[model samples]
Target: MSPFAKLLLVYDGSAEAQAALERCAQLSLALSAQVDVISVVDAESANAHCAGLLSDLAFHRLEELARSTLDHAVRQLTGDGIVASGYVSFGRLNDVVLRHTQAFNPDLVVVGHRAQARRSRWWGSRSAHHELTERLGGTTIVTVTLPGT
Candidate 1:
C-alpha cells in the first residue's frame, strides 16, 4: 500500500503555490494518492468601520477569487490524470488549513513556502509557514521551495 493514500495541498496562486501544486502532482502520481486542494480567502476586515454592506462585498470578492484560483489548480491536477478535488475556505491561513486538516484527515499535507532573509523576519514573529507546520503537529508535511528562494 502507498504510505500516503490521501494528500492535502494548500494553494494560493503564488509562484510558491504553483511549485507546491507541481510537487503534489508528482507525489500523487508516485503514490497513487487522492488529493484535496484548498485555497483560503482572508475574510478578516482591516478596518473596524468597514462593516455591514462593505464587509460583505469585500468578502464576496475574496471568495470569488479564491474559488477561481482553486478551480485552476484542480483542473491542472485532473488534466494530469490525478484524482483531485478542491474548495475555498474563509479565515486566517493557519486556521483554515488546520480546520481542513481535521476534516480531511489527509496522510500528507503539502505547502509552498518562499524563503525570507534572516533580516527580513521581525523579532518575536514567525512566518506563516512555520505557524502552519507547528499547528499541524504530527501530520507529515512536505514543503516545496521555489528556486533561488
Candidate 2:
C-alpha cells in the first residue's frame, strides 16, 4: 500500500451520490485523509439537439450548480470534523473524471452506482462512475451501492 492520504469523491447530486459523500466523510475521518470532491458536468448532453438553447449563461448556471454541489459535500465533511478540498469540471463525464484523477493523483476514488434496469444494462447503460473507476489505474475506487436495494 502507498499510504493512502488523499481521497477523491465523485458526486452527481443524486441520493446515492449523497450517500457516497457521507461515506467519504466517515472514511476521511478514519484514515485522516484529505478529500477532493468533484462533480463532472456532461457537456456533451448539454449540446444535444433536445437540450434546448444553451447559452453562456446556461453554462455559467451549470458551473454554479456544480460548485454548490461540491460546497455541500465539503460542508458535510467539515461538519463531521474532516477537512476537505473541492473541485468541479465541465466536460464529458468520464473524461472529466479521468483527467481529474490523473491531475490530483488521489489514493482512492469514491463514487455512487445507480441501479440499471435489465433492458438498460443490455443496452450498455453503464454510468460514468463505473467507467472512471475502471480507468483509474493504480488508484483504488469504491462504489457506494444504492440504498434500499
Candidate 3:
C-alpha cells in the first residue's frame, strides 16, 4: 500500500459523517495529503413525494444547502492546516461518489456506516457504503463507525 496523497471524504451532514471528517482531518495532517469533501444529494428521494411541487428555485436552494454543507466540512479540516476542497452532486449517492472517486483517483475514501435498521434487513439490507466498498476499484474504502456504538 502506498502512502496516502489524496483523501476523499463522503459527507452526508450526519453526526457519523462528521466523525469521519475528524478522522480524515487527522490522517490528512499526519500524511500531508490533500482532502476533497463531497456531498451527494439524493434527488430521487427529494422528488419522491413532492414531485412537481418542488419549484426550480427550491431545487436550487437544495443544491446550495449541499454546497454549504460541504464547505463547512472543508473549513473544519482546513482550519487545522489540512489542504481541502469541496464538491456537491445531485444523483444516486453511491453512483456519484464512485464517479467522483474515478475522476479524482484519490488514495483513500472515508465514509460513515449506519447501523442496519430492522426494516432494511427485511428489505434486503443494502446500502451505499457497501456498494462503494465493493465497487470502488482502485480507491481504498474506510468505513467509520460512530463512537459508543
Candidate 4:
C-alpha cells in the first residue's frame, strides 16, 4: 500500500501553484491518493487595507477570485482523470489551511512556495508554507519552490 493515502494541495492560481498542481497530479496517480485542493481569500487583510465600502467590495471580489481559482484547479485535475475536491475559505492563509488540514487529515500536504522579498522576510512574518510545515507536526509537507518572475 502507498504510504500517502490522502493528499492536500494549497493552490492560489499562481504559476508556482500551477507547478505544484502538476506535481500533485503525478503523485496522486502514482500513489492512488485522494486529493483535496484549497485556496484562501484573506478577507481580514483586505478589510484592514481598504476603507469601509471599498473593504466590502474588495472582500467580495477576493472571495470570487478564490472560488474561481479553486474551481479551475479542480477542473484541471478532473480533466486529467483525477478525482479531487476543492475548498475556498476566508481567513489568514496558514490558519485557514491548518483548519482544513485538521479536518481532511491528509497524509501529505503539497504547497507551492514562492520565496518572499527581502523586505517582507525582514518583517519576520513567515510564509504560509513555512508556517504550515511547522504547525503540521509529523505530517509530510512537500513544498515546490519557483523562482521569482
Q: Which candidate ranks first by TM-score, i.e. highest? A: 3
Tens-digit lDDT track of model 3 for 26-120: 88888889999999877677878586477777778888889888988988988999989899987988889888888989999999888888899
Candidate 3 Cα RMSD after full superposition onto the native fold (Å): 1.8
* Residue 85 error, candidate 2, Å: 0.7
Error of 3 at 134 (Å): 2.0
| Ranking of predictions according to TM-score | 3, 4, 2, 1
Model 4, stretches more than 4 Å misplaced?
51-54, 147-149
* Candidate 2 local lDDT, 1-149, one digit each (tens): 33879998988788989889888888888888889888877666886843667787877887888888888888888888886888888788778778887888888889887788899889988876667757777778888976685
Each model's lDDT = 0.89, 0.82, 0.87, 0.87
- The deviation in Å at residue 59 for candidate 4 is 2.0
Q: Worst 10-residue stretch by lDDT in candidate 3?
A: 49-58
Q: What are the candidates' C-alpha RMSDs?
A: 2.5, 2.0, 1.8, 1.8
Q: Please give the lDDT score for candidate 4.
A: 0.87
Q: Name the better of 1 and 2 by lDDT.
A: 1
lDDT of 1 at 148: 78
Model 1, 34: alpha-carbon shift in Å? 0.5
Cα lDDT of model 4 by residue, 1-149, tens digit: 89888899999999899989999999999998879999988877766676544555666788899999999999999888888999887789889878997888999899988878899989996888777888888888889877554
In model 2, which regions exceed 4 Å deviation? Answer: 49-52
Q: In candidate 3, which residue ranges exceed 4 Å CA deviation?
A: none
